[model samples]
Target: MKRRNFLSLGSALAGSALYAGAMPGAAAAGRDRLRIGMIGTGMRGQVLLRELVRRDDVEVAALCDIEPIMLGRAVQMVTAAGKPAPATFGENGDGYAYRRMLDSGKLDGVIIATPWEWHAQMAIDAMQAKVPVGCEVVAGVSLQDHWNVLDAQLKTGTPYMLLENVCYRRDVLAVLRMVRSGLFGELVHLQGGYQHDLRAVKFNSGDPTKPYGGGVEFGAKGWSEARWRTEHSVRRNGELYPSHGIGPCAMYTNINRGNRFTRINAFASKAAGLHDYVVRNGGEDHPNARTRFQLGDIVTTTLACDNGETIILQHDTSLPRPYSLGFRVQGTRGLWMDLNRSVHVEGISKPHEWDDARVWFEKYDHPLWRKYGEQAAGAGHGGMDFFVIHAFIEALKENAPMPIDIYDAITWSAITPLSEQSIALGFHTLDFPDFTGGKWRTRKPIFAFDDRY
Candidate 1:
């Protein structure tokens, strides 16, 4: 249990803890290999498991899923990796088995990667049990859910991290470095969105024998992992997936630091894209065609921050479009745009023009990326996924503060329910819930941009 260098575990485990000091049990398990439990081994869960299984100092001690097939697949994966087959839990109705797994008293932490609805409850249970949690992004289904998760972490003093891998993207981190260095002086506004073409993914039910979106399906059954996601689209209207856009932007603009989102006004375009796609592929009489989806093909959300900055976020996925987050960070001195890969800085470039962003990327790429870029590139989502998982593992090994703490998780996830309320009230201004409880005013930024191991 002696304190040891986290990097000594391995290169994959090597990374900065950012904030120093260990969590409640860091020293107790310092020498012992970290034992992590996996919850919800669906599509995304499997991807994370694969990355985790590749690590040497970590052990996938347990796996949980409602679906027996998914759980078996994950178990098979652990065995295939020539590692010990992890203990398995599945489908005891009403999440009973998941809670039982938590009570097993066998995990340093549990990673929740289930459908959207399950994240809040699972995280609450884990923290209450004095176990740290690393949950996948998008906090929960509603603003209140975010508050509950936030309250749990605060009350229990347990660490909770939102797995926002996009924040680890090389370019995004580079942008963060510049933001912190005053390269983008006096941050005035920021914009980003989840603009992927999810037409097929939203409709896919994971039934390989049954074609979905007129093609072979993959992963879990019923419409995109438990049918919850499609139901979310059918029932709600707002920025359903906001973290991918707001996560990195929040860091760049220093949310929970000097800046906090104060008010939000959102508008949703008419919902037509999903219905049209369903009819085109499955005919007008198809079940999905008859379902009236409230979610818009395009949702524009505007957020006002306490630091005199405004953020514009968009949710565009139901319609045909190429994948792009449409990340844009602007300030008095310079601006960056992701789609075109361009950047412009006052006094550093021609007047009112953009130079290739690659120039800046090559020159000012984040030190983490510069060192681990090749390894990360071999992982998912252009290597952002690798760093995110790596950072989480290291945090557990060191028992240090989480990279994406509960405050960031709730703030980014709360946007969904807040936007829904705003849209329902005809784009009326709604105050953002202060999950930090005013600590943002004095709390030092926990996310460090310094280069280190």
Candidate 2:
């Protein structure tokens, strides 16, 4: 049932008034089943689907994607677990299948893995419909998608969360505990980076054999070949794809906590050896081939928060660099960096200490993760995906604030587009709009809801 219908049903049961406590049957049948639908289930969609299926309290009531191929695997995933076959639909016929399904079903919430451009549009529609939303990547395509979610959430009174999964990393969570305990003191500045090479993970026109046709998160029959990057590239020049690289640190510094971003400047390098390598590696006759990459090889951005704290962000897609996201946080007392898959803390008479991500989990001799962590670990990003979704589901069941709340999302996602615009305007300082209207000042911390601590 819709939120309105649910509310009215409660009113009818209790004649003229309602109490802080629940009515008879209302308390018996709790909100155990949350009717949910998913949009954009490509690779990332599959990751979230695995997480959603684990909980007995929720079910994937509906599934929508642009291609039947994408939905097939997701369908098999949920059903193979003994759940009934969901009411499945595909926009393979049209790109708007997600919208049509939203109108037809009674969805309590939605998990959108749709492309960056559509992030704001679909999420806004879900919020307007009074459906809680958990979305991936970009907060808004332009100013409109950004402000629309803010207004819609306020007007309709629904939860709008950005599905930034990194905040749930076990090591990151342990780091938060350390920070909360003041192990990392008065963080003054930090650095974040998302560097990956997809040269082997070819896109539509990007491959020589044309193995897979163009159809991504925002699927459509003929979605202009050049439309790819607009949906994917996190940093045009030096914008931080904070969801992955900067996400954990945003939590550490309390981005939406008390300190927030004020302005940023992005500087990108010109075409490098890799650009020429990709070109020379391919013959001149590669049709519809890449001309000049807008997101040059490497990009660097510098941000200063309201508290006079600074953060350095770096982005790169070329070169055979190691697979890693550079994370560094510096404080008045000490500094922390994870460079070689090991965190190093220093700034003392003696170097603080260095520990691998495993060290934190080692002490988890406590079995919170052992029973639940195995299969999710078998799935994606060493199971961080499950951690994020688990946090979201528990929040709904308990009426607690979201771990990655709307403000957290807006603060992190805002960096992408603004960084692009900053590079476009030649590093001129651009204002980072606070979509929260400043309510972040007093809002409770969302992650504290975790009972595991």
Most accurate candidate by TM-score: 1
**Backbone clashes per model, in order?**
1, 0
Residues 118-190, candidate 2, lDDT per residue (tens digit)?
Answer: 7788887887767788888678766566677667777876877777766666666555555544445566778
Q: Which lDDT tens digits does candidate 1 get at residues 274-299? A: 88887887777755567888999999
* Model 2, C-alpha of 362: deviation from truth (Å): 4.6
Runs of candidate 1 exceeding 4 Å displacement: 1-32, 91-94, 209-212, 215-223
Q: Estimate each model's TM-score.
A: 0.91, 0.82
Off by over 4 Å in 2: 1-30, 202-240, 272-274, 341-372, 449-453
The positional error of residue 235 in candidate 1, measured at the CA in angstroms, is 0.4
Worst 10 residues of 2 by lDDT: 13-22
lDDT score, candidate 1, position 332: 80
